[model samples]
Target: MPQHHTLYAAFADRIDAVLTALEHEGVLPPGTPRGNVSVEPPRDPAHGDLATNAAMVLAKPAATNPRALAGKIVGHLEKDPLIAGAEIAGPGFINLRLAPGNWTNELHAIAEMGADYGKSGMGEGRRVNIEYVSANPTGPMHMGHCRGAVVGDALASLLEYAGHEVVREYYVNDAGGQVDTLARSAHLRYREALGEDVGAIPEGYYPGDYLVPVGKAAAEEFGDRFQAAPEAEWLPIFRAFAVERMMDMIRADLKLLGIEHDVFSSEAALQAAGKPEAAEAWLRAHDLVYDGVLEAPKGKEPPEDWEPTQLPLFRSTRFGDDQDRPIRKSDGKWTYFGADLAYHMQKAEGADELIDIWGADHAGTVKRIKAAVAALSEGEGKAIPFDVKLVQMVQLLRDGEPAKMSKRSGNFVTIADMVEEVGKDVVRFSMLTRKPEAQMDFDFAKVVEESKDNPVFYVQYAHARISSILRKGAEEGFAPSADNLGLLGEDDMALVKRAAQFPREVEMAARTREPHRIAFYLADLAGDLHAFWNLGNADTQKRFIVAQDAALTGARLFLAARIGQVIRNGLALLGVEAVEEL
Candidate 1:
């Protein structure tokens, strides 16, 4: 169902074999509804190449003991050319160990596919919008935004690799009151850039020194242009200059982290037809526009005589939201929710699915946004398919000391700054080493430790070690060659089997919306490579780069080359760097 592929076909064949034998022997009653079986490697290597709990699942309906059923299934499987050994393990588990060289065939497949080794087309050409790092344009991105940025970017890459049409988007929060404050702040900097020292920041305005650059640019572009003008005349010009500078800074920040956006949708631009009129009209057409009254703030009080005011509200409660939401304020101004609604609606028009990467604070907002989209679709099949993921806060430390910051331009640490402090590969890989929802603590010392504690290094080492073998083999006159992989030993075959499962691992990551799965799988694959390497350290003849016997050395080097390719391909999917040498 998730796109026909060769490996899945092999799995399907194994399932069918079990089902047919069961039916033929009448252990399974006719029309027993045999489907949904799966084949995966055993948790322990001793169990087998692949393990299926098929017998235990089938035993109840077949009216037979699980072990008995497993025996019968194994009997049928042993005769299959691909199945070298089928053993009935504890509790009716049929552990299928593939034939010799069958596992090695995976190496050849990896070699054949090269960079495309684990790529899959599971999304079936569907369109998806991945909105990420929607950090307010008022400032640079902080370490807090890094996880979501990497996750969203890697997820977009994963989806695109799996045949989804993905739009990498940035929702520029340029229309809000925040920008007004930014304009005022830039005005002060405009004066400062003109040799005026406006010390200390005003309470509600931005305080980063980065804004000084914007003010400098403003003075350069508008020397005495708006000094004597009204707030209205200077606000827009300052606002535009400030936002453009902030965006340029943000873009540089993203590039430093190796993250880039395909589209930047400006919130202010969404108000082309005027936010108040456009949003109200859209809400009115759906009967969602209504009068709304303000409640005295729960903990804070409104001014006395702040009589209940009536205004337009979006009836978001109609579509799974917890409560009706206001879209307009008493002063005939749009609420933050108004521009947000329009922006998502813009996304709905082109995307078959909508995915947003947000921080945990916006968890409550997801339902309302989805509610708006559902209400807009009128509950049709065209209903927006949306999913919002929250990235938990990250704690940064250096050599056991808290990594402290002093307002590094913009309010917090930028993604660019973090990547600059630590390389992009570690930043990309480590962000995903933990589950997205789980709180992650990034340590400067541990990240560059060069031990197994550093996952990026471990994985990169596996690739480089493989390359080292190829270098030694080439020096020994071994022409790169691979043949009769079936002659490979059990340990050699196990590595090949893991290579074959890469696509399945990719699909699992995409389906679960868990990029961490790839991280976990690559780590395990690296472990396997390391295990094989250690075996060579213990047994000289098994060493991949043997100076004696060039033919066997070539064969072993080919296997090492295959591992290197897979590691490179896997890292590329996660947007992590793959270094061939340490």
Candidate 2:
């Protein structure tokens, strides 16, 4: 086994050793900051296998010209057995082509590592708490919450693969006014179940028929005990019952899309524990909170009767927010920001880092919550890493027109509807085919189209094709073997190079906190495999099962098998299945 598992990582270490040698020989100055140096594949593959900007980055610090420095670096790099060719490009970039055997070794690594080929240890086992798809417990999961749910779940998986302890969380908003409205709605359905005419749902109540079941359950358990009770008497009991039922529906919908959370923190519980009161006292003691009058709202016409009231405000302006934010209203009730701050504080207690996946509509509140985290952590003499990722809305469409809303949800298409129509794999993969911050159109006609244009189908088809080839090769008495891999040609090595990039892609995607990159990388890898497969159409000799030469057939099957392994690994990270048959 090599010191570094991936080809690129191995070469990066080799470049570092060369720089250290140069420093020892006094050719380059010692203690020069090498943080800016980078080793990666050239933008143009024609340049070489690997390119490094070490000389370009260190030339000024070494007090020499970039090209001159590059020559010295190349002189040291060319001596290694792995370097088939090392040359200086136009200015100072050093491009080195590895011996074909190095890529062959990577293919062998894939076989040995199997499903663990692309897994990394970069996170060092740090705990990460990720809260995503925390839709209010007032309704079932809808298309509006689908993208963020997938992104967050995939990100949690990605971080785990990169060696982090991840806690998948959903913050239940059962303490809000929405749940109160849910109780009232469930009460109406309860009355209807009790043989009373409730008429049409009122203007402010939830009209979805999904609540009818909850109402029936209430009617069954209580048996008209609260049928004629006062609003105050049954509000609390019904609120808890309705919220629990809604959460059950939400969980079932998420399961259809293969998402599950590890934690379900409640806002009401946090308040019950006096977390907000403690947070407020801490902020006040540190002078981060004080009673102040709020200014007029921005970007709006001021009302003639608008009045400012003094309230306890957090000094968010000190941390770059536009204005100081009130933590509590004049009536002494905690505001939403106050509760959220305390919730984050609770989250920070258990993890080294915190990430919240929020809808784009919450963009306005990101800064304040971040500021609160900053204040709280900095006040404690240590700052915890915090990030808020805003996922934009997903527009559902059938064909080219807007899709119809589900009558069950009464507002938008439900997650269950999407999953049932297109299948879970299609829904998960389609949600991740684009960047989360950009608006996406989930066109039902386009996602399930069995063609190269559909990324999910194209990637899955590549795996299936490789599986078919391997099965036929076995039937023809040709088994995958690495003994004859040296016979592989340039076209075969091209596919090998693409498959070897999986480890690098995993590390990069985890570092950037962007799971969509895995989707994009798999699409490219699948394209490469399909291109290689099409070569047999031009010439029969290019096919994998060459009965005349069993060695060549076995070697080609080995390459195909490894390519399939890499595809399976990438798809697993995206929570998509690599089907053996299309």
Candidate 3:
């Protein structure tokens, strides 16, 4: 699109010229620094169509009053023929109007580019790895993980569309106390499969029937081998089988929600790959390892040997961490951060950039993770941009009431439950409809409803409505034509102009790692399209399929037809469907 700059580009160029002249004429200092300048439609269109803050930002920096600088910038901009007028307004802002033909040409760009109208190459084909939904393999995913899954997948798609080499990954928690607990639960279920009475589950043990199959499979494979062994003897065998089966079920559950990862990095594999011990060796080599212990957790006293025990530690505080982190526990086993450090160390091998999608509960852990990455990279933090997206909690609703999680299970709604009810599209779209930082309401009744309030329905319906119009137009021997798209009038042009925003917004969302922006942009475009479609009812001549004038109607139909393509293209990026009807 940069090769083919539209009227929008020319307007920006005119502003650039105004800035350049201001600097040259000494109205502003000769070498004053400036941030990237942006020109877009003003919030209140009555002031002018487009506005920029070039004057406001540079005013004090150039040692001049902001309003005075805005006046000077406006004076230089008013000379451009494409700019109908330029005004200095509120807080030294410069507002400019186009010559009425600029927006018309944006419509032509949409018709010409079709589905590719808004694509960008801003990424320059850099490699980016987005690791999300690393939900523990202990059970099925729930509503809380959906946000990360959708956001991660959408970000990967958006990055690819913006010309980046993207990889979506999931980190499996196959090694840990949780997996050991899973093994014991499976062993209990094994007893159940043998027709033995396995009484109530003990505390800290998995009590769900979901583990029964895992236990039965273990018994079939190992037989009475573990029946006579100690806890250590059965723990390994049980954990191996449990993690594998748990991962399989987790994958199936994720598939049901329409998500798949390109990579599945396992914590256990790090140990198998000789990386956990290698991390200990690494900290030792860098002088980052030290032996020290003093205080226990707040409000708790340590054991008898708690006095200054020399254990290995990673000097993470040197890289801006609040405090140095321990790598080896008092028992010499690697701490969780030790394995995570090695995991991220392994991640640094193939992935140029890493993004972790963590839930709100682990919000405090982000600082240490980033500090660890920086320490491991030896202070080159920008190359390995370890971004941690904190997904807020989900409060499920049912029958217009606050839905409570199963107290017996000790958690909120499961992903399987949400998928079974709202389906993949609604679940995915609803997860992305709001800012990740803000609270979102997921209404069961409204998600399934066929109303404009439902974003997924509204966007899909816009595409379907366009399909109907094109089908009707095809019956009248009309099809889209890039040659005569100028025949599309003001209302139709509005739809195209909005469609043209997708490519850039898609790139922006990816660059910023906020997939919610794409979801919102699609809805904005869909709203414009729906408004334009409804306009046909009020203005008969503006109807897409006009039987009387084939050429004029063909131009309008062609313009509107591509709007559906844009919507579908945008929806596809978010992993949301673009239905042709209904």
Question: Among all windows of ten consecutive residues in candidate 3, which has the lowest summed lDDT?
Answer: 1-10
lDDT of 3 at 133: 92
Q: What lDDT is obtained when candidate 3 is compared to the true structure?
A: 0.77
lDDT of 1 by residue, 75-102 (tens): 8888888877889888888887776656
List the candidates ranked by lDDT, beginning with the highest: 2, 1, 3
Most TM-score-accurate candidate: 2
Per-residue lDDT tens digits for candidate 3, residues 139-204, read 767777888788878888888877788888899988788888888888888877777787888988
Model 2: per-residue Cα lDDT at residue 138: 86
Each candidate's number of clashing pairs is 1, 0, 4
Model 3 misplaced stretches (Cα beyond 4 Å): 1-14, 17-32, 58-85, 99-101, 223-231, 284-287, 299-310, 316-322, 379-383, 404-412, 476-478, 481-484, 487-489, 546-551
RMSD to true structure for each model, in Å: 3.1, 1.4, 3.4
Estimate the TM-score for candidate 3. 0.88
- How accurate locally is residue 503 in candidate 3, as Cα lDDT from 0 to 100? 60
TM-score of model 2 vs. true structure: 0.98
